[model samples]
Target: MLISSSYATSPIQTYKQSETKPQNVVDEAPTSQGDTVILSKPALDLAAKEKGREFSNSFVMQVANQSNQKAEEMLAAFTYGLNNPLIDISSLNPATGNGATYTRTGQPVTDASEVLFASQNESLLKRNEILIAQEREKGTSAATILEKVMQSIDQQPQSYKDKIDWSRLSS
Candidate 1:
């Protein structure tokens, strides 16, 4: 006697919202490491595409916010040509049943993140320069000016300190 199972399940998981919450509220948010359901190749492709789109949107908005005045035009200019990344879905492996690796173009994302840090550093430096000039105008002693600058620097997040051009403030 020979027997075979012919059931195939799509990789999509559906969740019903709890009655206590409004229809607009979700019971549980889908996280990056959430449970996985075996889905069709197309469904996987769609999911990857959606994720890429979401990431691109968020990254552009964040980068735009780093502008000197957070201008909408600056945001548009900075995000020119930035688009949803191409997500590659690797073929499923038998060793990891119903598992596939996702790979996306990362260079642009990395560069954008760097831009955010650089912008923040630039802004900090500009503010410090203004404060230093104001102190000089008030006939503040060099030692006192340096002390004030150091205080301002200390107030900044630790990560940005190394990137600031400290020598500029001294001169």
Candidate 2:
């Protein structure tokens, strides 16, 4: 079976196994040609990638004949970080029991990196708000209202054309 995982954006999948002769287990109904495609472990792994595997997050591969759900679920395993933050695995010794062990608990990020990133994001958002307020103060135009006005005028020509009033008589 040929299976592949591609960029984060693509759905992960296992390769469709080449048709092998099904042993003499007779079935009542005939199966579709594609139904013969067997789902294997590799395919499931690919499925894991498909789900939450950001293309930039890991080595990406491209596979076919699989759904996106499976891949993403699998990817969740890798992305799932431990909840206990005191023991940073990135710089700890697990065997010596000095480093942290995974408690399967989720931790709210208190790292300086995360804080600074969030602060920067908030800063940028504040700047954006000011820019938008200025734009609105300038009375920036929206196309939707203009479109409606044009449509109404087109549908009712008399509204724009000056109609001759016969009731006024030949003045």
Candidate 3:
């Protein structure tokens, strides 16, 4: 005669809400280190409606990182195209460590102060010019890129939770 035994592994755990806080349902679910939280489209739309356009745009850009190429691809999904947009790259004052403002679709301006600024940091000015030119060539406006990122964010689930080891808790 022979005896055999089986053990359960990785079972889903459920918790009962505390009596003191009956109204609050606390869900402690285990999440892996690589897990990512994605926002739903309805949630994104709700955020945009509540926060306004500027905040939404800034939030999307910040989350997606400042890459014009990425932004252009996002805009393309929305059927938006950027024309040969002109970007104004102003010079910076090396002494004060200031003056690097770039504007899309604007004429380049150069004042006496700007001339001094550009001369002080010619390499930096040149790099900025190149980056702006490359972005313009991608054929999508910054606003449109931001909009696409926001839309993409909405397609993801936005909740993350960590499970607690019940064995460690004192009764």
* lDDT leader: 1
lDDT assessment of candidate 2: 0.29
Backbone clashes, each candidate: 3, 20, 6
List the candidates ranked by TM-score, beginning with the highest: 1, 2, 3
For candidate 1, lDDT tens digit of each residue in 85-148?
2112244344643322112211222344445645665665677678868977998654444445
Candidate with the larger TM-score of 1 and 2: 1
- Residue 55 of candidate 2: its Cα lDDT? 27
Per-residue C-alpha lDDT of model 2 across residues 13-131, encoded as one tens digit per residue: 12121121212334589778876877899998999976653323222212101334433343322122111122124434436534332111112223453444345434434544454
Provide TM-scores for the models. 0.30, 0.21, 0.19
- Scored by TM-score, the top model is 1
Lowest summed-lDDT stretch of 10 residues in model 2? Answer: 162-171
**Candidate 3 similarity to native, TM-score:** 0.19
Off by over 4 Å in 1: 1-109, 162-171
Residue 12 lDDT in candidate 2:
19
Candidate 1 CA-lDDT value:
0.37
RMSD of each: 23.5, 28.7, 26.3
Winner by lDDT between candidate 3 and candidate 1: 1
Give the per-residue Cα lDDT of candidate 2 at 28: 89
